[model samples]
Target: MAANAPFTPPLALASLSGEADADWARAGAAYAGAAFLGGIALDADSRAAARELVARDRSEFLPDEPITFIDRELAALGDVPIQPAFNVRSATVEPVAEAARVCRDRDTLLEINAHCRQDELCAVGCGETLLRDRERLATYVERAAETGVTVGAKVRAEVPGVDLPVLARDLEAAGAAFVHVDAMDSEPVIADVADATDLFVIANNGVRDTETVREYVEYGADAVSVGRPSDNPTVLERVRAAVDREFGLEATR
Candidate 1:
């Protein structure tokens, strides 16, 4: 079992369209224990894919030197109490390794992105495509682990023929410190993955009101991340209050 991240209430602000930078993290800092700051495209193939998404008017971070950009973004947090985590997309393992170095230097968590279902990203082997290739995804996790940063993956649920529980175990074996699951419509699957491995599980999707937050908590999620409504104080406050009420101080690590 991996040691839990220092996510106070164990709640996070999920990356939004690659725009969950420092400002976004700060905006939700009051309620969240951590914030995933990107679904950044880190290598040439992923960068090209990100550009394609941008062409379609989707938001993406396409910096010239991605490592520098990553360092800058993490640096911008400037001692916020919340854990700073970067969610990245890469077709190859090298970029993930490089980002791990930056994350290590900044004391940030590094998340590999296997949750993006974007056709453009998947076409380049950068996102949901990894969900289908367990070995490759594990290899990426293994390489990132070599860098000694707190590394993990943001995975999507309900991918056909993919057993997320098995995959979660594989990632745990590969030295993953945590697994952030986007439990699409199969919310109960959160329990399956959590049961499959001791890795810290962060449940995502439809995390709005107290009911939704309570559901994930009951399902064995060590934490929950708010998606589209991350910036909505009404929703985050409700979710935060629910988290505190459910998990309480004992939940803090």
Candidate 2:
């Protein structure tokens, strides 16, 4: 990512609020300076619990200072966005909505993640299974936006009967501001988003170098997300350099 390139969203966090407290330890690295750094895999129950567990220093499973380090750079890095991994079930459950509320009040971008494929989730009809329930998904999208938060959805390349392009459109109609397309497993990238029509798209998966980033942009992605690989710590530096260099070019223009 070039420094001048518009800021990309922080799509993944090193540590989830509840999944693995150890993951939070993965956050403080050389690349912790800026961007909306965050982790994922927090369920509704866990978020509430995590809030209750907030240490006196405001760190829970993670440190406030390091979190602050990333938040501080949000302005410098552009759009300090954070996506809380969510899987919606009932309006009453409203976990996704709760997460969005936090993001908006905190000035973070709230994204609904619909790409999980865990056997447990699928068996219970969540994650990708939700994609099959377009109407419900639409309602979920609407609910998130109504909270005054910028809405986004992360989706996988293929889902049983759902059409990706149509899903994109459905999401937009439901009030999504952005759509995250997961191109995991080195899957062949497909270009078919008539449904989303004109929503901002961010392609994730198998991304590391400048060329891969440019490829996604060429495919009409507004930006790309870098994750997991950054666990090496050195990879975080790569993202910093990539984002700075690209955005620098945009600045020159």
The candidate maximizing lDDT is 1
Top candidate by TM-score: 1
- The residue-by-residue lDDT of candidate 2 on 177-212, one tens digit each, is 777678765334434652246776666776676666
Candidate 1: segments with Cα more than 4 A from true spot: 1-3, 250-253
**lDDT value, residue 31 of candidate 2:** 40
lDDT of 1 by residue, 1-253 (tens): 2356546678999998767999899889989999999889999899999998999999988889989988998888977878999999999998899999999999999999999998999999988999999999999999989999988999998899999999999999999989999999999999999888999999999998779888998999999999999989999988888888777753553
Q: What TM-score, computed on C-alpha atoms, does each candidate reach?
A: 0.96, 0.65
C-alpha lDDT of all candidate models, in order:
0.90, 0.52
* lDDT score for candidate 2 against the true structure: 0.52
- Model 1 superposed RMSD (Cα): 1.8
